[model samples]
Target: MVILLNCAHHVTQRLQKTFVNYGEAMMYSLESCPSPWLRTHSMWGRYTVSFMLIVTQLGFCSVYFMFMADNLQQIVEEARTTSNTCQPRQILVLGPILDIRFYMLSILPFLVLMVLIQNLRVLSIFSTLASVTTLGSMALIFEYIIQGIPHPGNLPLVANWKTFLLFFGAAIFAFEGVGMVLPLKNQMKNPQKFSFVLYLGMSLVISLYICLGTLGYMKFGSDTRASITLNLPNCWLYQSVKLMYSVGIFFTYVLQFHVPAEIIIPFALSHVSESWALFVDLTVRTALVCLTCVLAVLIPRLDLVISLVGSVSSSALALIIPPLLEITTFYSEDISFVTIAKDVLISILGLLGCIFGTYQALYELTQHNFYSRVNFTGGIHV
Candidate 1:
């Protein structure tokens, strides 16, 4: 995985160096490359990259929605008293309803409002606040995780093939930020120092991912929920951690939503008159937020959603695209056979992960949907 990330960074830098005038977006990298295939079908490449990016960003937004709902629901359910005669409304978290869907619906308007603020500078204020709260929340979570961890020998080091594929999807999802590489480098005041920043930052990120994942699994073992937050004890501090994390994720929705909006909304508004631009933008933003909410409601399994998203799109963006881009862009150069072999190997690994991971995730999702329908039908019959 680390090797793959390094490869991605290398390709991204090479792309930027190859095309100095283009913007720092993934689509621009694809469009501006000197590949013969892309030169002939540059527009197609651009649109493909754009579509993948849109899917990846919106998948993130949907995951955020489900994540917040799951954590918030757990917090509320834990906080409420266990009464045999408790009314459905009494069991409700925020709105006058029960279940995760209601929570998603209740949060929809707020999310719409947040994404409506299209200015990156304005959104950064929210991002700053979210960062602070997120740090605090992580501290609390780490405190929770490190306490009384059980023996690691009891747990299986390697899961079965299906679970392994799921893990691959989830892991890919975690590192999907590879798409941001060029943009971050382009924005850096000292672009020359970006390699240092990239390596340092990625090392820290990978370390944290390893620590949290291994520790969380060792701590909770088989009983771990989709999120570590849900596995938190039903105590005030931990509950507050859930809420704090929820707030951070809530604020983060805008930044994730920003990418797709920048792509789709403008293109959509282009078809309309100048007078309708603002209205169309706001409407489109609201509609997109609602779309994510709807997706969250439909497939409320946070873990599976993450895996599915990662496998379906994140794998392509993070794994498949970079090496292929490198190979294509540098085809005319005197590149070594070993370099081509390495690129092909990396691309193959990504393709296998994508195919297997996607299949497993979709299979689980269908099983979930099937059982849900059966239960619903049974309840109706009763």
Candidate 2:
């Protein structure tokens, strides 16, 4: 994060200093860099970055869809089995026992409609509500976690190498907000203080992640589900937590969907006449939303899907690209050898993580043992 922020500081400073005519996005910075070595492949890198961003954002949307479905399914199942008065079964008459995919499909139309609102101002309202609900849910989850934490000796502080790859992938996903760093800095009235903002924000995020991860693991041990909310007691208050978090994730889906739609819809409509542009835009939006829902249904397991997406795309965007971009952008300048070496090392680590993490995630996705543990019988394959 320090290195990415430093690179972003450099990139944005260059944008303000020399590349004032260009855009402030990562792609623009790559395309307009002064280095001759970088210029040759800048176009390719630019397009690749766009593709990766699209994949990362859509991957997030898919994860959000699955997250909402999973939480809602757990809540509804508990309600149907436990509560005689609260009958969600009668409303969702698909079957006495609905699979996870049914829950994904049930919420498809609402998701599609939610993504149709293009105005960020309107979406910001939902985003604020999402934030509030998410914070509330996290508080409840933390309350649950601290209650039954077992001895540290009983837990594996360091997991084995094979399972570590999954952890690495998920960690990358959690820390994969580098794309927003530049945007936030650029929009700030006092851009010089952006570094402080970055430091404080990351500190809080990392601290919270560590607290929740360790305590939740200690509490649940082997029975921990993909989401900690799913492992909560099947009661009214905890079920409300599931519902609140689901609502938060549902609203967040559109925020994630916005970036890819902005990139894809404009490029797609460039080929068509102005008369049919609106129709094409709406069709593409609906199609993109439905596509994420399909992907979520195909891989209903939240943890595995999150790891797969993070390894495949988040590693590139968050870990690999920024350092390489820094090296490429500053290659023509009087950059120190140690700085260059450090950048190369970071990029190499990111590359290796991406390769191994992706392989491990894919292997788990294809294996029967993992599915057997989850009792996954969605028929797409284990």
Candidate 3:
């Protein structure tokens, strides 16, 4: 009887243990089961939201680029046709100071774009190169025009090949954003290997600039317009090139416009709905782009604008800002006096260029009406 009781007790204990283990297993199974329908629906909803967001952003970029195509073409066409003597009335009216303002204005979009975009390196490289190409072409054209001037005040300044070289060098100084490669240097996948790549890229750009400037100068002499596009031989080849250039310019500017709006939208969203913020941001950006395009189209003279931008806007940003930032930030480091001196010299050159170039443009503007004036003799004057 006692043995039976012991067996029964043992069985009871075993049953209790089994019951506890089963309960724990059941709980674990319940916890580990696939999510409920509501949970799955919520997760899918989030993914859908994310996908839609990405699609919307991409769609916006596409539409924006499409809208800018015509304007880009026009800019290219203008660049191709722009004479060495071309000057914009706005530059004349605004003066060098205004050039600085406009330069700042142009930069605003770039900065905004950088902040908004994911792949900034590509965008930056493209925009910088485009600007450089445009400006370089303008410089070549300007050189041609300056050479053509019968009694240019600074005739001796550009008379000899040596002086011409110096002038070209100065123009290149205005083309200074090549320093952008510096900031991007460390970002490369293999930074050490990139030195060769960077050097090669820069060499190619320098070579291209020299070739274009030399050819342009040879073709147009002193009468070369501000844009090399104008200097292009009016052959099928040239026309095709011009069309391509125009397309590039259009895309560059469109990207420029899109960048600012996209960046500002996020900031604006603090006070407004995402959609409304985007709308307002884009509206403002579009207005600015339209205004710039109108001015560029109406002004038509590439040289004057180029000179204005070169001397004032590009100079300040390219020459002034980087050195200043570098000095201020890296002052404690082993910076050389030579570097400081160089920065000062660059800044001075930029300032002088801005003043002199604007003066030239304004002097020209004052001498002639952009629109044809009718003479009393019933003849139209251009």
Candidate 4:
């Protein structure tokens, strides 16, 4: 598995570099060439990429809602209970009548933010904020991990097999974001320099991932919360860390939503009556956000949600689909079956991983409820 992931990572990194060279329209867009297993016989090329984009983005939106709701609810309850303040109105959502502790404080405000910022000039400022806050929060996390690592908390040196599956899902979830590469590369001012930038950038990302994963797992061990931020001591300093990270994530949420909106809005606008286009756009956007909120409420465990989404979607996005894209996009009569077989084998392993990891996640989630509305903020950290 280690070897497989390493190969996949290198392949994905290299493919992304290749995608930079593919010019404006990525070649893997949908087609209906029918076939039994491979070739232009089926819509495999198109559907794989499309499915990854939609499913992964949906997972992202759900995660955003979950993160926002849980963190906001945590602070709100802490504040309201201690001070006996905040007499907010009740809003009933899907049989749950939430009091002051609800997603409206998180989701609704952000819904407004989404509607407000359409101009790139205005949005770029928040993007900068997102970058800065993400870095700042990461630095704080490293500090916390470094301080805690020496204490050697009651963490296992290795996980049991069952638990390790969850770790697989979560690890991929943390590292997965390769889908954005082509668009970013395509928009770059210096396309030739992108290789240097991609390498330097991904190296730093891997370093941070390694440091956080190793140190965080070591430091928190069995005590780690859904997020490392949650493992921080509940003081003003650490609480501020959660909030700062939330701010970064919150800003990025809009950016994430923008892609899906662009995909969905034009389609809706084209179909609806000219007079009703604006109304349809607003309605569709609201419904999309609401759908994510519903999913978050339905499955409150942030770690499980992340893992499940990772297993179900990120596995393909990061592992399976890219290799297939390479096979179809770059292959010809000259390409050896051995090389093709190697690529096919990597994809097969990715598929197996996706299926196994997804089953493992669903099994864990179902252990709690078949479909019960468990409190979103109540899950113990992994």
Candidate 5:
């Protein structure tokens, strides 16, 4: 309910800004475009898109629920076999590393393709949606996960590795919005207006995440797993809510999937025969989608994927590429101490995060393999 209200408020704010900047003229243009078909179309297109996005969220929620349940059950079963205990392991410390890698692999190609394609409007929309949704959802998920966990005092362990990974991944995802900033910077009627919108949007997103995360951790505490869908309770009301949340997640992923494909198709086929290129592009896009889906199913570890995304793709695209692009494009500007300091800070942070995440992932993998080996040897002894 709060999430819904916040979303409404955010949209309203954006629309109000647009109205102030462009006046009724922008609305008129949308309504009275040159083509009759375009002009006649109702706001149905927007509503339809919203509805589809909701459904997509539900799909992702369902997948998350299934995956989380299976993961928890697997852990329980393993514990029973090994020690007859159902308590969760401190496995999350390693989980972030895998997440960083997976996300990097998934996003790198897509980000590159977007840069090459240079469709500013679409990129702006995609970036905004990715960042805002990722941040908002993180808060909601964290709130849900920690709903029932007990904490004795004010300064209780505010964050665990799992929580940290979840929030960090979200923060990284939030930077996706930065991609939209540059493109839209030139499009605004007043370039100065850009800073207002950019800062306002980011501040709102960060606030929302903090609120949601704090509430969620307070509620679910240490036992909270799967920061998104699985964190929520299983009552009918929650189930219904979960359905909506799931649909939202599905739409988010679908959008993420489509953005890269759309950008890549044109570039990948730039040199080919038009007809043949279109066919090839479609084939490649479809294959990529299938492969990602397969990997999601096989891996089914959201934490690992999130960490991988932050460490690799997010690091490269969000941290490295932006600064490089800025340096090359804006080289004429005199370099102030402030500008140099900010750039240096951002680069160092991004690099450290990536390295830390990668190390964690490799360490976890080694641990898992070693445990498996020990078990095999014990079995032989038996």
Candidate 6:
């Protein structure tokens, strides 16, 4: 916790200095630095970031795809008879599409739509709806969680130690919004208060995570879905919640997806003729989205991808990169033992997380074990 917070502050300061000292023009991303390696410039290091960014963004897209598909699948399955109190079976609106087929087919419309939008940032106008609908769905989930507190069925005080790394990775994935920090800070009306804003914002976010994680696990116990939203009852109101949440995520997808897509474009465009550039670029973007969807289908397990990406990328971005950047930017020579030890320790933790968490997630994926622990029914491999 100490290292994480310190890294956040240091990274913020580092970013501010980067904007001022390195000139704002050079700093294209939170991940960018003149010295990609330790006190030395290396194209290899830069490409490493690019590679991680590519994988990270693709993972995010897969998550969004899985999320939408899962919710729709839940709605369809539950429409038959998933609720208590003996309510009438609800109608399945989308007809008799196989769950996996729907997952793959549904992505096509978005893929085509994404290609049509020349200006990706234009989706920023929808950020308001994203925020509102996300919070609204969260509110509904929290209400369910709170109500479940009185009768939490066989809640465990201590989960298995092996699962700790998985949860650690997942938590990092969940907390990731640091990429937007620089932009949000830059756009603030009074940029001076950005630190306070960051701290306060992070505090609220952490509190919310604690509440959700605690209440959710307490309520659902071992039956907790990858997303708390999926645990909601199969009814008109809850189904509406899932739909609204999915829509919000749908719009937000293009927003996050645009960055890596933009980063890849310049390199891709350089190879094509001026007249064919637009067509080729669109082709590349479409292919990337398709690849992401394919990955989602293969590893339909939401837990695996979220944990793997978080363990693989989030750990490096949040814990490893910032510390190294700090060392490079601040101390050219004669760094202290304390500083060296801190970074090395944090980096090791990050590495252990990435290695183990990724292994666990991948192993689970190979076993086709997306099913909840208590309800494992030998899931079909993709």
Worst lDDT window (10 residues) for model 3? Answer: 373-382
lDDT of 2 by residue, 148-239 (tens): 46786876566678777887788888854655455445555687897897898789888888888777777766556677776677668778
- Tens digits of lDDT, candidate 6, 50-156: 66666777778788888788777766656765454523223323333465546556765765575456463455566667878988988877776677264655555
lDDT of 5 at 353: 72
Q: Residue pairs in steric clash, candidate 2?
A: none
Among all candidates shown, the one with the greatest TM-score: 2
In terms of TM-score, how similar is model 6 to the real structure?
0.80
Relative to the true structure, candidate 4 reaches a TM of 0.78
Q: List where candidate 2 sits over 4 angstroms from the true fold.
A: 1-37, 81-96, 184-194, 369-382
Model 1 spans with C-alpha error above 4 angstroms = 1-37, 81-97, 185-193, 370-382
Q: Per-residue lDDT of 59-156 in model 5, one digit per residue for the tens?
A: 23323333333333333333323343323333332122233224324442443343333345564465466555555645545544454555746535
TM per candidate comes to 0.84, 0.86, 0.50, 0.78, 0.55, 0.80
Query: Which residues of candidate 5, in runs, are more than 4 Å off?
Result: 1-170, 178-196, 365-382
Cα error, candidate 3, residue 330 (Å): 2.5
lDDT of each: 0.71, 0.73, 0.41, 0.62, 0.43, 0.63
Best by lDDT: 2
**lDDT value, residue 28 of candidate 2:** 48
- Per-residue lDDT tens digits for candidate 4, residues 239-286, read 666788888888877766665565567778999799998788888888
lDDT (Cα) of model 6: 0.63
Q: Which regions of candidate 4 deviate over 4 angstroms?
A: 1-44, 80-101, 115-122, 148-154, 336-338, 369-382
Which structure is stronger by TM-score: 2 or 6? 2
| Residue 306, model 1: Cα distance from true site in angstroms | 0.7
Off-target runs (Cα >4 Å) in candidate 6 are 1-41, 80-97, 115-121, 151-153, 183-197, 333-337, 369-382
Q: TM-score: which is higher, 1 or 4?
A: 1
Clashes of each: 0, 0, 15, 5, 34, 0
